[model samples]
Target: MTDHIGTAPVRDGLHGGGRRRELAAATVGSVVESFDWNLYAVLAPYFAADLFGHGKGGVNGVLAAYATFAVGFVARPVGSYLIGRLSDTRGRRLALSLGMAVIAVASLGLAALPGQRSIGVWAAVLAVVVRVVQGLAFGGEAPSVAAYVTETAPPRHRFAFSSVSYGGIILGSLLSFGVLTALIRTLGKSGLENGGWRWGFLVAALLGLGAVWVRRAAPESEEFHRARARQRPGGRPPFLRTLREHRRSVFTVFLNTLGGTVGYYFALTYLPQYAAAYHVIDKETAASFMTVVLAVVLVTMLLTGAAADRFGLLPVARIGFWLPVPAVPVLLAGLRGGWLSFQLVAVLLGMLVATVLGTLNVFTGLLFPTEVRAVGLGVVNAATIAAFGGSFPLLAEWLGDHHRLGLIPFYVTVCTAGPAVGLLTAMRVPSFAAAVQEAEAGIQRTPGSA
Candidate 1:
């Protein structure tokens, strides 16, 4: 099962076309899930005035809108716990289907909900509620899908396969950017304010439904089935078991994700807003640039994953996390000046961020065994993403408003530094990949007795 790339052997019972189908289902579902989740952020500025009203209060209104977006992150950890437990107890296919169903309903809800003019603050309230639902669903969806892909992939190809989920995310963002750019050109600002933003959400809802249908036929991960069968009846819940037994893995993942999530949000999600807010670029231009940046990221992500398979995960991950440390400051310096310089530096930084995230999902999945894999990743990812990823834009906006724009790059540098240090330190201990292989071997040996 081992390959020339030095990846562990592929697990039995999942090979050939069967594995490809599972990866396809998982990738499509991820794309749809991310599309639904990111639609609001992509269209936020266009819809802000409608949802929160206009005037000087408009600035506060946009912030409020972003705050509502962050509210979804607040619900992620809860979703992670509940859904992760469900995935461990039930099955990956069921958990994924249910998560996609929630995303579909939530996206459609956002699409159909009344605006502030029609319902006053209630409009914002309802939006927040829908975001929470989406957040919860995503909390479960991301980790479960990552685990499923890793478990089912040919061992040598796990990194590449796991990158598919990240690819879906980038593709989703690219789709959002394309839709937004098209809407801007066709609708203009007024039309977008009138009702055009809803189209994005509506489209996401449809795609989510399509993803659910596709996922319904996906085969359950063989590894999950084997792991579940190996668990003793009435044993402790997976979450608790994970906390007690895999504390180091959980902590390591948290530190690693803190950097990756922060870098991702800072570099990709908030870049357009940052450019617009600081007058570095117009909104339209920023969106166009972001579309290009996302395309670059998508390519870099896949390449980094492939590299991880050939080289070692630690070395690849180290390069990803460390490169951004020096690059962030240089990019920020460029942003303070000419547009051409800013765009060049920004693209370079975007690629660096993509490199980190490209390998991160697979690396995180390798940190835990099948028994606690889903919950372990869900909790750690949910926690970091909520705390760092969710707050990134808000924090950047706040800093910009206060004339502390200089602090932004430093913030990004600190975030990246922590994970770089953690990765280097962890490399000295039991390797995460080896630990994962050992755990899998143990499961194969004792089919009904963990």
Candidate 2:
């Protein structure tokens, strides 16, 4: 009970249909986030040279293409600040809808883009431009959607609501894989290689448009309205001051989420590629294997979300961090095991580590007061994703290329190690809701003191 922080008293001012609207918005946002981001990762092998190379530049071309992928992650902080600020001041619905529209435009542009053969280096340049746009959109989209779901859920069901809403990440990735696999099979490898990959982005663009409509239909949170009501009409506080005051919360969000991002990008999104690259299986088998693994992960996420509601968020999340410490080392121990051998262990860890992700957005959003929840979370989580998630594949490939696979487990362990202590210290020593109340009431507590 002590570890279980209480939900906000201002949960969901609107009821019934309003709750459905919030959940739908959150789910669609998660799906779009997963789809467009992973579309590149999934389709990179086929399209990387088309967009980045001088023709059959080998693995080096793919590597160059993914650099743009990393750049996109690096661009997220800018979007987070711009759109997160919008979410807090205007409304979550507007921010969510706007972010989706950005991604939709980016996706459509990428789908229509000509390859390097036609456009030269500008093709790659334009690719980064599009990805940066997506990163910015996602940067804002993620936090706004997270805050909306958390604020709109009933207090007792916050964990479950957050879990169910964010489960769209898995659904999105699954659909991505399914789409690609079907394309590979129907078109055969040559047809896909020729130009079939663009269809994936075309699909992502359509989904982004649909998500924008769904978010528009979703209701705004009562919590944000109340926070705005308390604000002096023409006297909004400067964001710089809010950042300075809430610096501790931002750092805490970093510690809590860094590992989860790595797990999702590496263990889940990158697995099919990792397996195929190492000769463990062909792309089709790897994709099929991951589809099954992700289905299990989805079920596991829902179960953990329900568990968090029944037990507590931190208790459930602590297991998520520690489970990967041992599991990851075993996966790459020999670095050449069969699919049923070490690869299975890797996917298992994927499912387990995802528990933290199931409720992470909601937990992070709740760590701030309603007034600044979207912006702070957007910035910190985007930074964390940029550092860990975006660069994970590159790091793994670099280590594997140099035959240093053994160190990867240590890297994953180090990432997961901080959160157990940091979340307990930062979120629950005095608690987030408590800190927000104290700040509002002009009660000062020294930073970092227990």
Off by over 4 Å in 2: 1-15, 54-59, 233-236, 334-343, 433-450
What overall lDDT goes with each candidate model?
Answer: 0.77, 0.76
| Best model per TM-score | 1
Candidate 2: residue 396 Cα off by (Å): 2.3
Choose the strongest candidate by lDDT: 1
Clash count per candidate? 0, 0
RMSD of 2: 5.7
lDDT of 2 at 139: 89
lDDT tens digits, residue span 160-187, model 1: 7767677898888888888888888899
Instruction: Write down the TM-score of every candidate.
Output: 0.91, 0.89
lDDT of 2: 0.76
> What is the Cα-based lDDT of residue 37 in candidate 1?
66
